[model samples]
Target: MTSNSDTPASGFLPPRWFIRAAWKTHKALYRWSGGRFGLRTPRPDRYGLAYLTTVGRRSGVDRSVMIGYFEDGDGIVTMAMNGWGAPEPAWWLNLQAQPEATLDLAGGTTVPVVGRRAEGEERDRLWERWRELDDGLDGYAARRPTETAVVVLDPRTD
Candidate 1:
Protein backbone atom coordinates (compact mmCIF):
# COMPACT_ATOMS: atom_id res chain seq x y z
CA MET A 1 0.00 0.00 0.00
CA THR A 2 1.09 3.58 -0.68
CA SER A 3 2.13 5.81 2.23
CA ASN A 4 0.67 9.08 1.07
CA SER A 5 -1.27 11.20 3.60
CA ASP A 6 -4.61 10.31 2.02
CA THR A 7 -3.72 6.64 2.02
CA PRO A 8 -3.53 6.38 5.77
CA ALA A 9 -7.25 7.06 5.84
CA SER A 10 -8.07 4.62 3.06
CA GLY A 11 -5.04 2.40 2.49
CA PHE A 12 -5.37 -0.34 5.03
CA LEU A 13 -8.94 -1.23 4.39
CA PRO A 14 -8.34 -4.82 3.24
CA PRO A 15 -10.39 -6.35 0.47
CA ARG A 16 -14.03 -7.16 1.21
CA TRP A 17 -13.34 -10.86 0.92
CA PHE A 18 -10.60 -10.73 3.54
CA ILE A 19 -12.80 -8.83 5.96
CA ARG A 20 -15.62 -11.31 5.53
CA ALA A 21 -13.26 -14.22 6.09
CA ALA A 22 -11.87 -12.63 9.20
CA TRP A 23 -15.31 -11.92 10.55
CA LYS A 24 -16.49 -15.41 9.80
CA THR A 25 -13.43 -16.94 11.45
CA HIS A 26 -13.85 -14.74 14.50
CA LYS A 27 -17.54 -15.56 14.77
CA ALA A 28 -17.04 -19.28 14.44
CA LEU A 29 -14.31 -19.28 17.06
CA TYR A 30 -16.41 -17.19 19.39
CA ARG A 31 -19.35 -19.52 18.98
CA TRP A 32 -17.27 -22.66 19.48
CA SER A 33 -15.66 -21.20 22.57
CA GLY A 34 -18.96 -19.98 23.99
CA GLY A 35 -17.69 -16.37 23.86
CA ARG A 36 -15.66 -16.71 27.05
CA PHE A 37 -12.81 -18.75 25.60
CA GLY A 38 -12.44 -17.06 22.24
CA LEU A 39 -11.29 -13.75 23.63
CA ARG A 40 -8.40 -15.51 25.33
CA THR A 41 -7.08 -17.15 22.20
CA PRO A 42 -3.72 -15.96 20.95
CA ARG A 43 -3.39 -14.79 17.37
CA PRO A 44 -1.75 -17.68 15.50
CA ASP A 45 0.84 -15.84 13.44
CA ARG A 46 1.85 -12.84 15.52
CA TYR A 47 3.90 -12.73 18.65
CA GLY A 48 2.26 -11.20 21.72
CA LEU A 49 -0.86 -10.48 19.75
CA ALA A 50 -3.34 -8.12 21.35
CA TYR A 51 -6.42 -6.20 20.36
CA LEU A 52 -5.84 -2.46 20.48
CA THR A 53 -8.69 0.07 20.46
CA THR A 54 -8.06 3.73 19.80
CA VAL A 55 -10.20 6.72 18.91
CA GLY A 56 -9.70 8.33 15.53
CA ARG A 57 -7.66 11.54 15.68
CA ARG A 58 -9.95 13.28 13.19
CA SER A 59 -13.17 11.29 13.14
CA GLY A 60 -13.54 10.76 16.92
CA VAL A 61 -14.82 7.23 16.43
CA ASP A 62 -13.26 4.24 18.21
CA ARG A 63 -11.18 1.92 16.02
CA SER A 64 -9.70 -1.42 16.90
CA VAL A 65 -7.02 -3.61 15.29
CA MET A 66 -5.27 -6.79 16.27
CA ILE A 67 -1.49 -6.40 16.21
CA GLY A 68 1.71 -8.10 17.28
CA TYR A 69 3.22 -6.80 20.50
CA PHE A 70 6.40 -7.46 22.44
CA GLU A 71 7.53 -6.55 25.92
CA ASP A 72 10.34 -4.01 25.91
CA GLY A 73 11.85 -3.82 29.38
CA ASP A 74 8.76 -2.55 31.26
CA GLY A 75 6.83 -1.26 28.25
CA ILE A 76 4.91 -2.95 25.45
CA VAL A 77 5.99 -2.41 21.84
CA THR A 78 4.22 -3.21 18.59
CA MET A 79 5.57 -3.55 15.06
CA ALA A 80 2.94 -0.96 13.87
CA MET A 81 3.02 -2.32 10.34
CA ASN A 82 3.52 -5.96 9.52
CA GLY A 83 2.09 -6.85 6.13
CA TRP A 84 0.64 -3.45 5.20
CA GLY A 85 3.71 -2.33 3.19
CA ALA A 86 2.74 1.18 4.33
CA PRO A 87 4.63 3.79 6.32
CA GLU A 88 2.35 3.30 9.26
CA PRO A 89 -1.06 2.05 10.17
CA ALA A 90 -3.99 4.46 10.61
CA TRP A 91 -4.38 3.34 14.23
CA TRP A 92 -0.77 4.26 14.89
CA LEU A 93 -1.36 7.68 13.39
CA ASN A 94 -4.36 8.10 15.65
CA LEU A 95 -2.22 7.21 18.64
CA GLN A 96 0.35 9.72 17.50
CA ALA A 97 -2.34 12.36 17.83
CA GLN A 98 -3.75 10.89 21.05
CA PRO A 99 -1.12 8.89 22.89
CA GLU A 100 -3.44 7.27 25.38
CA ALA A 101 -5.17 4.11 24.21
CA THR A 102 -6.48 0.74 25.32
CA LEU A 103 -5.07 -2.76 24.76
CA ASP A 104 -6.90 -6.03 25.25
CA LEU A 105 -4.65 -9.01 25.87
CA ALA A 106 -5.14 -12.72 25.44
CA GLY A 107 -5.77 -13.14 29.14
CA GLY A 108 -8.77 -10.80 28.90
CA THR A 109 -7.10 -7.90 30.64
CA THR A 110 -7.76 -4.41 29.32
CA VAL A 111 -5.24 -1.71 30.11
CA PRO A 112 -4.49 1.83 29.02
CA VAL A 113 -1.11 2.67 27.49
CA VAL A 114 0.78 5.65 26.12
CA GLY A 115 2.32 5.30 22.66
CA ARG A 116 5.66 6.72 21.50
CA ARG A 117 7.59 6.18 18.29
CA ALA A 118 10.95 4.43 18.64
CA GLU A 119 13.96 5.44 16.56
CA GLY A 120 17.68 4.93 15.71
CA GLU A 121 19.51 1.99 17.25
CA GLU A 122 16.70 1.35 19.68
CA ARG A 123 14.33 0.81 16.79
CA ASP A 124 16.81 -1.39 14.96
CA ARG A 125 17.31 -3.61 17.98
CA LEU A 126 13.59 -3.95 18.53
CA TRP A 127 13.00 -4.81 14.90
CA GLU A 128 15.70 -7.42 15.06
CA ARG A 129 14.04 -8.99 18.07
CA TRP A 130 10.74 -8.98 16.25
CA ARG A 131 12.34 -10.75 13.32
CA GLU A 132 13.68 -13.36 15.70
CA LEU A 133 10.12 -14.01 16.79
CA ASP A 134 8.58 -13.87 13.30
CA ASP A 135 10.69 -14.01 10.16
CA GLY A 136 8.04 -12.63 7.79
CA LEU A 137 8.63 -9.17 9.26
CA ASP A 138 11.83 -8.99 7.22
CA GLY A 139 9.80 -9.30 4.04
CA TYR A 140 7.25 -6.77 5.28
CA ALA A 141 9.98 -4.25 5.96
CA ALA A 142 11.39 -4.65 2.45
CA ARG A 143 8.07 -3.92 0.71
CA ARG A 144 7.78 -0.37 2.05
CA PRO A 145 10.80 1.89 1.96
CA THR A 146 9.30 4.18 4.58
CA GLU A 147 10.97 3.32 7.86
CA THR A 148 9.03 0.84 9.94
CA ALA A 149 8.90 1.83 13.60
CA VAL A 150 8.28 0.40 17.02
CA VAL A 151 5.57 2.01 19.09
CA VAL A 152 6.36 1.73 22.76
CA LEU A 153 3.14 1.74 24.73
CA ASP A 154 3.84 2.37 28.38
CA PRO A 155 1.36 0.96 30.83
CA ARG A 156 -0.68 3.51 32.69
CA THR A 157 0.36 3.33 36.33
CA ASP A 158 -2.70 4.96 37.76
Candidate 2:
Protein backbone atom coordinates (compact mmCIF):
# COMPACT_ATOMS: atom_id res chain seq x y z
CA MET A 1 0.00 0.00 0.00
CA THR A 2 1.13 3.54 -0.74
CA SER A 3 1.54 6.08 2.03
CA ASN A 4 1.44 9.88 1.92
CA SER A 5 5.22 9.94 2.01
CA ASP A 6 5.16 8.16 -1.32
CA THR A 7 3.52 11.18 -2.94
CA PRO A 8 5.80 13.66 -4.68
CA ALA A 9 4.31 16.59 -2.83
CA SER A 10 4.86 15.05 0.57
CA GLY A 11 8.26 16.66 0.82
CA PHE A 12 6.69 20.12 0.89
CA LEU A 13 4.09 19.32 3.50
CA PRO A 14 4.32 18.41 7.13
CA PRO A 15 3.23 14.96 8.27
CA ARG A 16 -0.50 14.30 8.19
CA TRP A 17 -0.62 13.83 11.97
CA PHE A 18 1.03 17.18 12.55
CA ILE A 19 -1.34 18.86 10.13
CA ARG A 20 -4.37 17.39 11.91
CA ALA A 21 -3.05 18.31 15.32
CA ALA A 22 -2.50 21.89 14.23
CA TRP A 23 -6.06 22.13 13.05
CA LYS A 24 -7.40 20.81 16.33
CA THR A 25 -5.21 23.18 18.27
CA HIS A 26 -6.28 26.12 16.14
CA LYS A 27 -9.93 25.33 16.73
CA ALA A 28 -9.39 24.94 20.43
CA LEU A 29 -7.68 28.28 20.62
CA TYR A 30 -10.47 29.90 18.67
CA ARG A 31 -13.07 28.48 21.04
CA TRP A 32 -11.16 29.18 24.22
CA SER A 33 -10.34 32.72 23.22
CA GLY A 34 -13.96 33.60 22.54
CA GLY A 35 -13.28 34.24 18.88
CA ARG A 36 -10.46 36.61 19.61
CA PHE A 37 -7.91 34.73 17.54
CA GLY A 38 -7.52 31.98 14.94
CA LEU A 39 -9.26 33.80 12.06
CA ARG A 40 -8.37 36.69 9.82
CA THR A 41 -9.31 38.42 6.60
CA PRO A 42 -7.91 37.25 3.29
CA ARG A 43 -5.22 39.38 1.77
CA PRO A 44 -4.38 39.80 -1.89
CA ASP A 45 -1.82 37.02 -1.95
CA ARG A 46 -2.88 34.95 1.03
CA TYR A 47 -5.90 33.08 2.27
CA GLY A 48 -7.65 33.92 5.53
CA LEU A 49 -9.02 31.58 8.16
CA ALA A 50 -12.67 31.44 9.11
CA TYR A 51 -14.99 29.36 11.22
CA LEU A 52 -17.75 27.49 9.43
CA THR A 53 -20.71 25.74 10.98
CA THR A 54 -22.70 23.17 9.11
CA VAL A 55 -25.42 20.77 10.09
CA GLY A 56 -24.41 17.12 10.44
CA ARG A 57 -25.73 15.07 7.55
CA ARG A 58 -26.93 12.21 9.71
CA SER A 59 -27.15 13.53 13.25
CA GLY A 60 -28.59 16.92 12.27
CA VAL A 61 -26.32 18.48 14.87
CA ASP A 62 -24.26 21.55 14.19
CA ARG A 63 -20.63 20.89 13.33
CA SER A 64 -18.12 23.69 13.24
CA VAL A 65 -14.65 23.74 11.71
CA MET A 66 -11.86 26.09 10.80
CA ILE A 67 -11.38 26.55 7.06
CA GLY A 68 -9.04 28.55 4.89
CA TYR A 69 -10.87 30.93 2.60
CA PHE A 70 -10.58 34.04 0.51
CA GLU A 71 -13.01 36.78 -0.35
CA ASP A 72 -14.37 36.77 -3.87
CA GLY A 73 -16.41 39.89 -4.43
CA ASP A 74 -18.91 39.56 -1.60
CA GLY A 75 -18.68 35.80 -1.25
CA ILE A 76 -16.09 33.49 0.26
CA VAL A 77 -14.21 30.64 -1.38
CA THR A 78 -12.51 27.65 0.23
CA MET A 79 -11.25 24.20 -0.70
CA ALA A 80 -12.49 20.85 0.51
CA MET A 81 -9.03 19.46 1.02
CA ASN A 82 -8.83 17.34 4.14
CA GLY A 83 -5.28 18.11 5.21
CA TRP A 84 -4.32 16.96 1.73
CA GLY A 85 -5.60 13.51 2.70
CA ALA A 86 -7.79 11.19 0.66
CA PRO A 87 -11.11 11.54 2.45
CA GLU A 88 -13.36 14.54 1.91
CA PRO A 89 -13.59 16.94 4.79
CA ALA A 90 -16.65 16.37 6.98
CA TRP A 91 -17.59 20.03 6.80
CA TRP A 92 -17.64 19.80 3.04
CA LEU A 93 -19.83 16.73 3.20
CA ASN A 94 -22.18 18.45 5.57
CA LEU A 95 -22.39 21.43 3.26
CA GLN A 96 -23.23 19.06 0.43
CA ALA A 97 -26.03 17.56 2.53
CA GLN A 98 -27.17 21.05 3.50
CA PRO A 99 -25.78 24.00 1.64
CA GLU A 100 -27.23 26.52 4.05
CA ALA A 101 -24.68 27.28 6.73
CA THR A 102 -22.98 30.03 8.68
CA LEU A 103 -19.52 31.56 8.60
CA ASP A 104 -17.83 33.26 11.50
CA LEU A 105 -15.34 35.77 10.27
CA ALA A 106 -12.67 37.50 12.21
CA GLY A 107 -13.64 40.46 14.43
CA GLY A 108 -16.59 38.43 15.72
CA THR A 109 -18.75 38.89 12.69
CA THR A 110 -21.09 36.12 11.52
CA VAL A 111 -22.75 35.68 8.18
CA PRO A 112 -25.24 33.13 6.89
CA VAL A 113 -24.02 31.47 3.77
CA VAL A 114 -24.83 28.78 1.22
CA GLY A 115 -22.11 26.44 0.06
CA ARG A 116 -21.63 25.01 -3.43
CA ARG A 117 -18.87 23.59 -5.57
CA ALA A 118 -17.35 25.70 -8.29
CA GLU A 119 -17.36 24.27 -11.80
CA GLY A 120 -16.22 24.92 -15.34
CA GLU A 121 -14.56 28.30 -15.78
CA GLU A 122 -15.57 29.31 -12.29
CA ARG A 123 -13.64 26.47 -10.73
CA ASP A 124 -10.62 27.17 -12.84
CA ARG A 125 -10.70 30.82 -11.97
CA LEU A 126 -11.00 30.28 -8.26
CA TRP A 127 -8.38 27.57 -8.28
CA GLU A 128 -6.02 29.99 -9.94
CA ARG A 129 -6.69 32.51 -7.22
CA TRP A 130 -5.69 29.92 -4.64
CA ARG A 131 -2.60 29.04 -6.63
CA GLU A 132 -1.42 32.62 -6.41
CA LEU A 133 -1.67 32.44 -2.65
CA ASP A 134 0.41 29.32 -2.04
CA ASP A 135 3.14 28.27 -4.40
CA GLY A 136 2.72 24.67 -3.20
CA LEU A 137 -1.05 24.67 -3.55
CA ASP A 138 -1.04 22.37 -6.56
CA GLY A 139 1.56 20.11 -5.03
CA TYR A 140 -0.52 19.64 -1.89
CA ALA A 141 -3.62 19.10 -3.96
CA ALA A 142 -1.90 16.44 -6.06
CA ARG A 143 -1.29 14.42 -2.91
CA ARG A 144 -4.95 13.50 -2.88
CA PRO A 145 -6.20 10.77 -5.16
CA THR A 146 -9.11 12.93 -6.34
CA GLU A 147 -9.59 16.56 -7.18
CA THR A 148 -10.02 18.82 -4.21
CA ALA A 149 -13.35 20.61 -4.33
CA VAL A 150 -13.51 24.39 -4.63
CA VAL A 151 -16.29 25.46 -2.35
CA VAL A 152 -17.96 28.83 -2.71
CA LEU A 153 -19.86 30.36 0.16
CA ASP A 154 -22.34 33.03 -0.82
CA PRO A 155 -24.43 35.11 1.45
CA ARG A 156 -27.85 33.66 2.08
CA THR A 157 -30.55 35.98 0.77
CA ASP A 158 -33.22 34.30 2.79
Give me the overall lDDT of model 2.
0.92
Segments in model 2 whose C-alpha atoms lie over 4 Å from true places: 1-11
Clashing residue pair totals per candidate (backbone < 3 A): 0, 0
Q: List the residue pairs that clash in candidate 1.
A: none
**Candidate 1 C-alpha lDDT tens digits along 1-158:** 54432332333345556855774576466446643444543343446656778889999998777666777777888866635544567888999999889987776588899889888888888788777776555554655778777888889877
lDDT digits (tens) for residues 77-118 of candidate 2: 999998989999999999999999999999889999999999
- Work out the TM-score per prediction: 0.72, 0.93
lDDT of 1: 0.70
